[model samples]
Target: MKTMEQIRHLYSRAGFGLRFEDMRLVEQLSVKHSIDFLFRSSVQSKPLVSVKENVNYKDFLKDDQLSRKMFMMQQRQQEKDLNIEWLKNMSTGNTQLRDKMTLFWHNHFACRTLNAWYAQQLNNIQRDNALGNFRTLLLEVSKTPAMLQFLNNQQNRKGHPNENFAREVMELFTIGRGNYTEQDVKESARAFTGWGFNKDGVFAERKFLHDDGQKTFLGNTGNFTGEDIIDMLLAKKQTAHFICTKLYKYLVNEVPDAANVNAMADVFYNHKYEIKPLLEFVFNAKWFYNEKNTGNLIKSPVEFIVAMNRQFYIDYQNPDIQIQFQRALGQVLFYPPNVAGWPGGKNWIDSSSLMYRLSIPATVLNDGVIDFTGKTDPDDEAFIATARKEKKAVHTRVQTQPDWNKFLSDIPAHTTKKEIAQLVLSPAINSKLLSIINKATDIKTMVIELVSTPEYQLS
Candidate 1:
């Protein structure tokens, strides 16, 4: 049998932590088999279909402020719906690794758009390329309408080049900051001039608007197009190192081991930036399963909520309640805070956010309530506004009852609460919390008590 810690660590990294049935299944497999299973399952995955909302923008395109406002409001609601669909997939989809890696790439190439169609399309792009080669993913993302619009690349032209996309391509997406100079950004922008999409959300090139001139980028002088610039960037070893560092932090631990990152980069670069092999190398590494890496990173709001849903099979009668919970927890899907996306880790937790996070399991599983009326930071007012706009009662309550029979049946009859605790939590349970949990009368109460502890916050 796989050790409880080994199984827990596998689920924690491969996807969210396992439910009881998931644990039972994983217990039968060796670690290598488990990793291979996740990869194979994800590779065969299909794109997620977002729930369609029937809203005709043409009806509201009357060239008036009220019309524009109505259109925007409708789009915003549709975006929320799309987010709910993705959340549902993450919680229950068979291709768990695809969903997890899509989330990783979403933050990596963070771009926000109010258009629901663009948002849905962007999500598909992330999913499609989540396990593919990095070079192809980079090129596809750069050409997408949502990304071009978000970075103002559509405004770029031959004489007046907008450097926003080029700058981020290096600083945020590729080799990272300080690896390339400002001159490189300017030259790269020139090469990327006329890179835009048509109104039908199709990728189109405007040859007349493009600048065809020799430019020096990274000490190489050539008449480079946007594609050429991307090709050159991918050729650098720094790009591999930068990407590997991010993958390490996301999958392994927040504080990356430089040597491990460098080793992974070698494999990544040698294989021409294919993501699957890099992931395989990471999972196969001896250090990845080290005890020090377990429970080292804090769970982001999305991870926390999705894992809870996966474990308990949660659903909200009013879908808006799900959106409100996400907002209150500080991660509104399809609406990243900025271009850099959610900082995650320590940034995900604070006095207000942590209280909200801790209360989620109880609120959903036990019919507990939440109060939002209090003095708060200006930055958080947006979430409060989103909550207020919801037509349903804002106070917390369980809308859908959980099906616990499967989970209960999966556990052995002789298993104690301590053994259950070990399976549920990644970090070792604190003695004080364990003492309190040991007094619980039954398994249900024990679960609630275990999940509510601070230890549960670190997955």
Candidate 2:
């Protein structure tokens, strides 16, 4: 049987872990209640972010090089601000499963924002659909203006259809590679030709641009629509296995045994692709909290920082410093390095990035001050408050330094430095980390040193 503490650790590393109070709540609840809460709490649509809308999408294509570059830069800064604000709510908000599901879906249908406004919009959409029906998410993603533009679906039309979105939908999103053929992609491309967005960023099916000809997809011949193509793809058992394998790697262990994966796929497929059912079955499963899985994985940069901030009640008005640190730490806002998104876990640690991760807390809680240019104001406290208040607001700045002593005051005094190491370290305490924590005289130093460890990368 999994102990409560071990279960909490599993949940933490699997998602953002738990808040201190949440940990207490989970401790008190029956496993069924605890599991049910994960799904029930996530059933609502996330509140929309408040960003400056009515943007002219055409202005981005200005002929002047300087003007375009300036526009791109401003847009990038705005996206960073938006991301920082979202992070604050994600870390501190009342709803736990919503943020966790948002994180999961962001990786599921990963798209990067080249423009800040577009990225901010994309981020909000992902949050809105985080806990909705899987079919709804897939359909929403297909029509999302940001996705349509990012994957070049805007160029997909009657005569010359771009197959980028179609290829990804089959290969990356639904079924794994090689489950479908080149002919399937070509046919799917034809079906999705008219799936695009209007000027106001809403879905539009342009009949004039649509390929109305019959398409032979997966041995089925018909004048299939884009929705039909998706429906056909989901009917395959491979889609279930592909998604289950991903969930296993993320929520269970990185290296899932084949037997477990097959079982998960069976449950997922039988459940009609409702994500909550699969997850509840997994979290409630006896093997989910096994010793081999507990604290064995590493946290992604966003998860690492957000969990810590929430646990300590660490608030930042000016997320620029944190944002700069995030960039330095190899996971920048609005920009994913490529289409596949961040590899995450152990991949988040490298020689250059590791040093920056170790150094970030000091930067935020001590002497670090982020430089601001353009219209962004880090000194505006109201902006910071707005930014952190469950929705969109400009990021704020911190005039006072963080107090480490007060930060760990709530942790039991009876707790040893080793226990503190275990509480935060992702991969548990290896000798190097154990040595560092052992040498520390007090909880504050031990906390910092443990975070600075190689093991800390796992949290």
Candidate 3:
């Protein structure tokens, strides 16, 4: 692969896509230097805090007369603001890989919560430990208030053990399904009983409620605790393989390359699940830049929004439009479809969503009309508000200001349409598509036209 192609592919998979500011610097270096640059630059990540004022979560718990309707309204608004803020964060800055990886882990360890404080804490945790260590990330995610409440681990207790938490910890989070048996789930559930959060949202064990009985799990017999079960899961090589394969699908291609994934698995296992090294290995590999793997994967809804914003150097006039786009495209932030998370790949391109996905660039850039007639997420207050506001209107405008001049300044004067297409798209367009793209009068027009096409839907 050429250096530029490799760089674009790496950035697309590693981060979002190459930023205009990084263009000059990246052009001077090879793929290896770019890999080092990306890893080195992401050593520190900025935290996302939508709620500036801290509120005591326990205060709400203590209030006996707190109105349920008022609480739901507050919770929904807080989460909506948070969702938009994170999308805005993802759109700008040098924190592409860090923020992008956080998005990956967000879906990987899916948890839903009404408490915005707990949600913010969990997101920052993912960002902080995104490229650090899988062991640390897994442990922290497993213990978070969001996860505990989402999986009903807070209800787990002796003689009334909730198997929901234990089953997911094994089947979804750590090792994939089939690595353990039903008996393992039952035993592990007993071990995890009494694992609940305190009033302050801290992990606390209800000692009296815990079943401190000796149990056999995954062929090991002992008086195991929840922490012990986690340790045992990490010890299994299959855990590494499961995570690696999933990563391979996300970063490389939807269809995993078994040989390359096995190599990645070895690195992840031997390095004790060090995320940075495993990703470095993948980015450094020649097979990762192969033509077959270049642009086959469809862009997830979040990725599409981020890439568009970055490419245009866009600033949304109404940031709430982000949640609209997300809801329309079938991947709202902070809201996974279920415990298993959003089923990515082709699932992102259903008949309803694909039309909106293709029309997004035009809607955001050209002030074109955008309709949210596809589906409505009743859980999101912002979405419902948007729907109600525009219910009678035929053409609702997407409020965004794209700085095309600033972005166009970054493009070299000598660059060809073909090269520009390669930078914006994954797979090369056909002759007919090229003829269509050639109709644009200027570079900005060409780009706006390109992004509006079906080919631009893939990253």
Candidate 4:
């Protein structure tokens, strides 16, 4: 039998944690076969549907502030709908690796837009290229309306270049900070001028707005276009190493293995930034299964909620509850805190957030109620104002109910409370928590207690 720990680790990193039925199936396969299965399944998954808004841009452009406000409100509603769809996919999508990698890339190439159409387009681009070539992904993202608007690249012109997009492309998205000079940022921004989108949400370059002058970037002199600059950046070995280090920290542990990352970087760079080969190398490495890496990372809000839904089959009668939960936990989908994206790891937890996290299982699974009022950060006045407009009061309760039969049916009769606890939680549970779980009268109570423990926060 595959060890429970190994199965848990595989599912935790490869996708969301597996359900009991999935675990039983996965235990039958060898580790190599399991990894292959995930990649193969991911390759075959379909793309998410694009957002279709009924608002007319021409009408909004006219001199009427009320019409513009209505358009903005429609976009906001569409964004929320997209968020709900994505959550549903993560909870039940057949292709787990695709969803997981899509999330990774979303944070990696973080951008936000008030235009819901552009947001959906960007999301689809990330999903389509999540397991594909990093170079292609990078280029596509740079040309998207959502990214252009978010980074202020639409304002870039021949004589006046905007450095926001160029600076972030290096510091946050690629080679990281300190690897490139400020002069390089200035030159790169010059090359990327005139990159903007039209009203139809299509990328349209304004020829007159582009610089078209010779520039020296990263020790190379040329009349480079935006694409040329991207190629130059990807040509550097530092870019490969930078991406590899991030992948290691995200997929393996917070503290990356230097030698392993170097090897992975070599593979990634040699393969022309194909993401699949690098993922294969990491998953196949024997060191990946080391105990030290298993539970070293804390679960982000998305991972925590998705994993719980995967196991318990939570069905929220109203989709707005998902948004409320995400807001309370401080990781709103598509709406990151800032340009740097969610810090993740330990940043996901504070005293207030932790208590809410711990209370989620009991509140959602047992009582089927969640009070949205006062749970969110009081400082988010914009969100508060929006909530009030939507009539989402403090007394709002989630009409959530768990399908316990689906959860319990997969647990074998011979499995003990401790064994079930091990299956549900990542890392080892503390003695006090274990004692509390052991005192439960049956499997249902044991599960609720186990999920309530701090150990459940790790994976």
Better of 1 and 4 by TM-score: 4
Over the stretch 1-459, how does candidate 3's per-residue lDDT look in tens digits? Answer: 779878988899988887556778899899999999998888888888886653554556645554644666677788889998899888876877888799989999988887888888899999999999998998888888889999999999999989999999999888999999999999999999988888778888889889999999999999999999998999999999898888888998899888998899999999999999999999998899988888888999999999989888888777887888888898989989899999899999988788888888988888767877635557754646855865442346787899877877887889887778778887777885698668867777787778888888886
Q: Model 3: residues >4 Å from true position, as ranges?
A: 52-67, 380-395
lDDT of 4 by residue, 20-93 (tens): 78876777787887888888878765655647653446666975887777776676778789888898999987
- Name the best candidate (by lDDT): 3
Q: Write one digit per residue (lDDT tens) for candidate 1, span 224-280.
A: 999999999999999999989888888898998999999999999999999999988
What stretches of model 4 exceed 4 Å from their correct place? 1-4, 54-58, 61-69, 375-393
For each candidate in turn, the TM-score is: 0.93, 0.86, 0.94, 0.94
Cα-lDDT of candidate 1: 0.82
- For candidate 4, the TM-score is 0.94
- Compute the lDDT of residue 90 as modeled in candidate 4: 91
lDDT of 2 by residue, 50-144 (tens): 45763654766856877876765666556666777778777767666778777777777888755555666666677776755577778878788
Give the clash count for model 2: 8
Higher-scoring candidate on lDDT, 1 or 2: 1
Worst 10 residues of 3 by lDDT: 386-395
Predictions in order: lDDT: 0.82, 0.71, 0.85, 0.84
Best by TM-score: 3
